[model samples]
Target: MSGAVTSVFGIEPGDHAYLRYAGDDERRLLRAAHVTAAAGRGERAVFVDAGAWGGHDPRALPGGGQVFVLTPGEAGFAGGRLDVPRLMRVLDAQADEAARLGLRGLRVCVDLDEVLAVTPETAPRGDGGGPGRCPLAVLRGRSRPPAVICHGDRARLPEAILPALAERHPLTLDAATALTRHPLLCVRPVRDPAGLCLEGEIDDSNLGLLARALETAPLDGRDLRLYVRRLRFADVGAVRLLAHAADAMPDGHRLVLHAPGPVIKAVLRHYGWDRRLVLEEGDRG
Candidate 1:
């Protein structure tokens, strides 16, 4: 990871950003980074994850910021269905608590997939139809509302309501995409495909870092795939390094490259490195 601090998606207070992660590990990684960044900025962070189902304890960081986790029951889910208004009020109260705690700002990261799995398809009566009554209304309070990041895993999302889900958010983004340029590369573990996610650019500067990460990556006899849909650039040296990594895999367990961009594809083809790694057209998720 780069030492440079940067926004993963340019998310700001009062902005409701939608994120689609490749798997649970990726979601957890991003969630931790988001919460830590918020705390570093002296903002109270509220995170909603599956672990909260087992009752997560609130944590206080050294930066004078605290984290609160909302449990499943606390989220206003009665009889396996979500109470949107109740959840909204709970979030508002959390923000008020943050204010009282002397936190400068608020940040909330919700595992939307886990919470919405039990949510009803139809909207609750008068929940979102009127002014200041919508579930997201809590995010646009009179004072500063918390910066909100809602995460979903497409594999776990209900196909019946996926379209409606996307329609609700204005700025939807893939978790693989990198919003900053300085990092040059960001690697995340993916569980569904049992591989690694490569974001941003990969060149001579970070080729060694990539090599080291690959060396430490788990390869349990299955082919390791690299998700590179958001990889912006890759030099010939990087291609060569990947080729070597693929060559080193156990027999019948090739390194798979998912959604390589035109630049990487062209480089692989030009140098005949594509023969070393299995190339897939799209992300499995």
Candidate 2:
């Protein structure tokens, strides 16, 4: 599976890929080809069509993949409103079925902008009102999960939702940069408590990337918790950035560092960041 390129954005597993397209028929076919290639590599590809199969060719889809055409007022909706929970349940069932079939994992390609646009009232609340409650939030909370690609039309999606969307998704791509490759660093948003998770290694090479990720994090005046359990290494600069994030938190709110090992803990204490940040050991749970 390591040899297979499971994501259209070339991102690693357990990361969300955001793709911005111009909403043309050609672009739709290109997107289908990406998903089809993933399905050919033993991954169960599921594409949720917000366009309801208009101008798309099912014959182009690879074998052993599923495509759902979601109509706004379809029977799956409640009172003409798209049922977010029910939609999620259907995806969950697909994941289960994929596991039973002994496939690598499920790969979901969805156009959430269309979904949200149709159901304006069901738009996800971003003020930290509830943890792991929103559909997107619930999807991010899953551990050891599938590869997901979220599609959005550049002209159609509202500007207000892009920041929140980018925060949840690590790799953002557009039609022009869709095929470009990126460095390997897994930075994902935590769902239950609503924070950020850092995996893989952080070093001088990717410091700028890390800074941009931190800047775009949806802190929103709430306590920002960073889970670094899977983080293998952090240079001094990275540690300083973490300290700065803590210091930059709003008054009365704190930045919590979760599960930093002895080495990272010692570095933080040595730099006197122990006074600036709240450090916690053990599992994030």
Candidate 3:
């Protein structure tokens, strides 16, 4: 149980893992994983909820670990806006309480679905500026708890803000796809190159997810590049999907794949799709 949380969620103690969930089902899965992991590690778990828990009450977890559900109002929200600083204070206090109770560590899952609904322009930021700039950054620096900053209901949060928020954390996982202990595939939007960054494996199980990513990606008439250097394995079905997406693009607009593996290239070449999809052998760096 020493590395229970890390083994399950790929999140180490005192590290912040960002989760972008599509809906409540994914959120529930992640929440359940966190609860089980924290209990295994004998750590007190605090769920800071802002309408993401669906009105679930806090209860005692297994192995003598306790769970606390915190609301925005309980964290001291003065005005109409959700004060991020106050939220940090609340989280710190919870950590202190966990320590006083002789718990091994603290684990927090913050559901920011309601928070993002109100502030859709950008992610919530704190007052101070520096290494520990944003509220979540400060939380990471202080408590060092294995924190899951859940950006729930992906439709509510703007895609433009995902990159900036993701950069602040060590790991960014999509709840819709990252169901296992270790992530199978991670699809993230690239801003400058105007493409999608695909990491990990893409198989039949996650082919539909990849299709949705390509369809929803910001697509202009220009080339829709896919940064696949970190993508280790992609099955034939996934390769075919990419080729079809590239073929569907407007004239002179193709899907550029950077550092595609042998499997992808062989599949495309065998199916006569290598011509339609632009494959770059060299690294994009």
Candidate 4:
């Protein structure tokens, strides 16, 4: 709501780097700001390099010197290929999220043949680069080359993992976006001593709800039991909600996010909850 940019990196929200923290118009504006900021810093260029699964965003900023994204290719039938509708949805989510990060106007580049500029280009004849092929990642900035050479250890990746990327990519990306916009989101579950159970929606809509639940728990006294089954379905919004909730937690109360995170735990991991939200016995406080 405040769209405060939290830090110099603008990595956090309290810094006021964003506007709505979760909207298109606001995201676009903020993204533009980031782009401008990056440019101001004297950075040569910015890139939206796609991952192996071929991440898609609704729009890629065209004004920048150059911008691109990775998409599925027939390289080896890794994930077969996603249909247009599916690709668009993924693209849209990515585009929206990117905008929030201040990289609006991005465009999708379908390169399955590994035709783009990959890092460690030309392979290490003997420098610091690898001798074999290079790996793929969300590369950005400097000169903004056209994906020099697609490289990454795709051998271990299950062929189907590529196809299934769509199934989980959106959720993963959304969770990440939300966390960036609201790093304050974190949790500490308090269980019920009489009956080990925690009831609440792990979604962003109810961050406040989760906070309320945590507030009523007696975490400092006993080990609290928590069920994150309810948190499996949430977006960046929830992260902010969580951030808001965590910022209000009482000292000494512990929260436990009970294993196997819903979305990629890495998405929320960066915020680094660090006992900030303690998980203990049920809400018996």
Whichever of 1 and 4 has more TM-score, that candidate is 1
Local accuracy by lDDT, each model:
0.64, 0.59, 0.63, 0.33
Q: Kindly report which residue stretches of model 1 are placed more than 4 angstroms away from their true locations once superposed.
A: 1-9, 52-65, 79-85, 117-134, 178-285
lDDT of 4 by residue, 55-145 (tens): 3352354544433333343221123222434434454555555555554223222322233222223321111133231122222221221
lDDT score at residue 282, model 4, on the 0-100 scale: 29
For model 1, give the RMSD to the true fold.
15.9
Q: Which stretches of candidate 3 lie over 4 Å from their true place?
A: 1-8, 52-56, 59-65, 76-85, 116-121, 128-134, 143-148, 182-285
Candidate that would win on TM-score: 3
lDDT of 4 at 234: 39
Q: Give candidate 4's whole-model lDDT.
A: 0.33
Error of 1 at 36 (Å): 2.9
* Model 2 steric clash total: 0
lDDT of 2 by residue, 263-282 (tens): 45655775588899888776
lDDT of 1 by residue, 192-239 (tens): 547788886665678888998898775535887788887655555777
Worst 10 residues of 3 by lDDT: 1-10
Estimate TM-scores for all models: 0.50, 0.47, 0.51, 0.31
**Which candidate leads in lDDT?**
1
Clashes of each: 0, 0, 1, 55
Off by over 4 Å in 2: 1-9, 52-62, 66-85, 100-102, 118-134, 160-164, 180-285
Residue 39 lDDT in candidate 3: 51
Which residue pairs in model 2 clash with each other?
none
Which portions of model 4 miss their true places by more than 4 Å? Answer: 1-201, 217-225, 243-247, 260-264, 278-285
Write the residue-wise lDDT of candidate 3 on 112-223 in tens digits.
5454333324354443222222355446666354455555557766676666666656667777555664457799887766788888666667888899999888753488
**Candidate 4, after superposition: displacement of residue 160 in Å?**
21
